[model samples]
Target: MTGTRFDPSWFEAHHVNLSATERRAATLTTRRTVKKDWQAAWLAQAITCIDLTTLAGDDTPSRVQRLCAKARQPLRDDIMAALGLDALRVGAVCVYPTMVAHAVKALEGSGVPVASVATGFPAGLMPLSLRLAEINYAVDQGASEVDIVITREYALTGQWSKLYDEIAAMREACGPAHMKAILATGDLQTLGNVYKASMVAMQAGSDFIKTSTGKEGLNATLPVSLTMVRALRDFREKSGQIVGFKPAGGIKSAKDAIAWLILMKEELGTRWTRNDLFRFGASSMLGDIERQLEHHVTGRYSAANRHAMA
Candidate 1:
């Protein structure tokens, strides 16, 4: 099928059912990771948060540029503070390049990190060196994590080597920061492409391999997330290597977050801790999750009670 279209079965072949013992082992791992001081230290992490700058990309009179700018600091702070104050493990705060420092500074000491999108993000349309520079600049400015989008065209066309190089370049650029490689899964034709992309991304040194850019038509989905989580699990078993998983884009609400958590429980199981193991990568999701927490904790919800970070 070199010249033919990619088939999802090409990937399904390796994803067989686990044995009873294997399943039990997976459950134990999940309990350990999920049960860790999680209630007091981080409850929202029961569903990781998200990265959202493009929410301003719509055609509203709200002005995308200024909205993006405002969403930069206030959104990050709002997310961090709400999660922080609620005693939920605040997930990382994601931001665009210029505002990463603000996200970094605002999230300081909260155990929440600053995640910056880079490497010709969204479009992945730029020179290799320039992309690397963008990554380095963000990390140097205090981003604890770097999310770099892969050239979807390259991955789709079987240009695995080029894709590998881009991942490696971005990894090097991140220095000590965790590098999350965005597959922009919607652009790919099949699950096989996502599988191949995930393996290649991890092999090329990405600390985490994400499912979508949140800019793609479909963004993240259960099937797509299941594909990546399974890939990461298998890769870990054989290589004794652990790679993180993130399902970004379109994820809003506690139910969506719980569904993703269920997928992680069934697929990757316990190693899915609060940090690099998983994250939501959203803009508005934190607030939604907060409302859920408030309802669960205090049994009341009012628009006036919603806290916004100054």
Candidate 2:
């Protein structure tokens, strides 16, 4: 249900020009502007689209629970009241596979879905059997969505067929849960590869094609995001099916979120701007957004310490 049957020809025919893409990405930030209440409103929408996350080497059950709490009630009561919002919650909570059960339990009774990073996240270098098993294990543990990592080697080695097969298997293993394929584009090395991998993943049934794992030295740049979204557009035109996009890693500021939102609106139209189709896989971004919203309502800036993520 997530992606269509794989067709090698679809991916082989795709091509992207780096210069044109760079030029387009460079204009996304300056072409649109939001001020005062309008900016506040966009920031609030960004809050709801966030996959409020906590994936640290030293993450504990307590930490995951705290993060879940923030996901359920992302904004302060005063801020919500001032903004005239009765209930505001983030899109989901993303955590490592080991913490999926904890995140699910913590978000019990809340509508927020618990998303777990699977398939040897950040590197995705494990055996194919182990990766598929990991997806099944997380789904069994009550994860509503599974964020899987594609084998970067397949992309690097130009093995599009191997990459497509691996993602198709992962999608099958995900069963009822939605599957998000993380391309880890930083290692893909070129915008052309990013476009190819995006197409391959979509063909293999990726519910969402994510930009990064947040572990890469260079992750989630505007040019790369533009390339991926254009691929999504091309995919939709050919297949008449819509796939989602998620940009993870280093997107910490409210300004950065606005830029991404503009990109979605300008390229894919406003339909892709909602929580179902777009997500920001971030942890610290919520704090900054909260602070900006508070400034808009109260005419004063709050210290970053005042807006704690968890």
Candidate 3:
């Protein structure tokens, strides 16, 4: 994945008006509608773009193995046949650094990549050296992708230079593994901050810019997502480079997934909807999507219990 060259001045000069951003975000949901089979198809696409994740303190090897099995075959056999999708699968399986080995072992023959959240994940407060080492460890343990959290203090304090340098080092540690820089937008406080941070991460060579860590008080919201998407558009226009986007946390339903997919298509066009360019960092969301697909095919809503993650 080629990354854009770092340009601190470009990000420092960026500005985002909150009111206009909110207005645009409000209309995203009502702007387009995908109904019936079209909606089902969109949901299937959403499934393929999901980074099926299990980031928990109590996550075990068995749990990681089960999650890998689900990632390999995201949809049940009946649902896949009904949708005429014989080879459906999630984009990747994300787990903690320690769980990366387990996930890799379980998904050995499958093509699904194992993603590990590193760099003091969720709360990137550790020292830079340690964070970088953690990333190396995860990659050595067989992680194809590393989701690293940025130091929110840099964004909060308007330290664009520091933020850019930090992300650049993390990217270097990732080496061959793709890097997703989580901005933890919920803590950034403003849309403008979100936009600037997005630019900094992209400029610093992040393959993807993620919305949240799913451990924050608030996570991926429509308005914040819009701000970040527009930032991606600007980055692509100025540098002629395309980067992926991931809206994590608080997205838990088929309807919510379609909403984000529509946002990507409408804002960045069709190219951003694919797994290579977009992803959902979710755990329980797959279950809801499966339930909706079942309803679409069988015309009967099944209990949530019937669609377990593993």
Candidate 4:
């Protein structure tokens, strides 16, 4: 989904009430609960929306292949059968730009896309040309999705036009690949800034406005995510274009997964709960989800190491 042209009015007047936001966020987990068969169903849906990820320094082709293997079959066959599921797969496999080809080759014909982090991931302080070139490199290597980090300096300095131009250029470079703009909300200082940054990214043509790069000091919090999704809902009402949301850090449990799913459903409707509109950028989250599912099936909690990730 292409974004609208840069429009400051769309979010300039936007003011996020910290108290109200925090109060609402606090109720997300408490207001709703799912259990037994319903809980198992929601957990299965969360697996499908996961962007199974591996972005460590020690990553290797073999390790990426292992991650891809897990993406293709996120749940063990016995556990899936117990849940009455015929097939299960994660939304996508995210890796660094250099690892795109390896992931693409490994996940071939599995219907799971390879998402590469480009545009100076985690920091995005590189030159604009270099950042755009990195996105092109990932696309040329067969990545169907590209996750790009926005230059926080631009957002911090309130240079919305420059920020818009930077993200728009990166979006163009993405070509046919879907672009996910990581706002690194933890570093953005305020919920208002997060809201404004989300609007600018959506205006600049981002297919998804993500909460973090999983590298920030603070990651995916309910208040921060709530701010972004409200911005997404506003953008949709105005532009008639649907953009996706991703919460990418500090999310590592089956409980956390269900909490986020509940958020999406309550705030953006059931459509946002699907993998196409929502994704969890997590590496260790899958293991916990699998462990919970196993316990649900066998009535015995398994060791964490029993469900290892790549």
- Clashes found in each candidate (C-alpha, N, C closer than 3 A): 12, 0, 0, 0
Q: Give the better candidate number (1 or 4) by lDDT.
A: 4
What would you estimate as the lDDT of candidate 2? 0.92
Clash-forming residue pairs, model 2: none
Model 1 misplaced regions, further than 4 Å? 1-43, 47-86, 300-310
**Candidates by lDDT, descending order:** 4, 3, 2, 1
TM per candidate comes to 0.75, 0.98, 0.98, 0.99
Candidate 4, residue 32: how far the Cα is off, in Å: 0.8
- The superposed Cα distance between candidate 2 and the true structure at residue 243, in angstroms, equals 0.2
lDDT top scorer: 4
Q: How close is each model in CA RMSD to the real structure?
A: 7.6, 0.9, 1.0, 0.7
- Candidate 4: which pairs clash? none
lDDT of 4 by residue, 1-310 (tens): 7788788999999899999999999999999999999999999999999999989899999999999999999888999999999999999999998999999999999999999999989899899999999999999999999999999988999999999999999999999999999999999999999999999999999999999998889999999999999999999999999999999999999999999999999999999999998999997999999999999999999999999885
RMSD of 3: 1.0
* Top-scoring candidate (TM-score): 4
Instruction: Looking at model 1, report the run of 10 residues with the lowest lDDT sum.
Output: 1-10
Q: What is the lDDT of residue 174 in candidate 1?
A: 86
Instruction: Estimate, for each residue in 110-186, the C-alpha lDDT of model 3 and write its tens digit.
Output: 88999999999889999999999999999999999999999999999989889989999999999999999999999
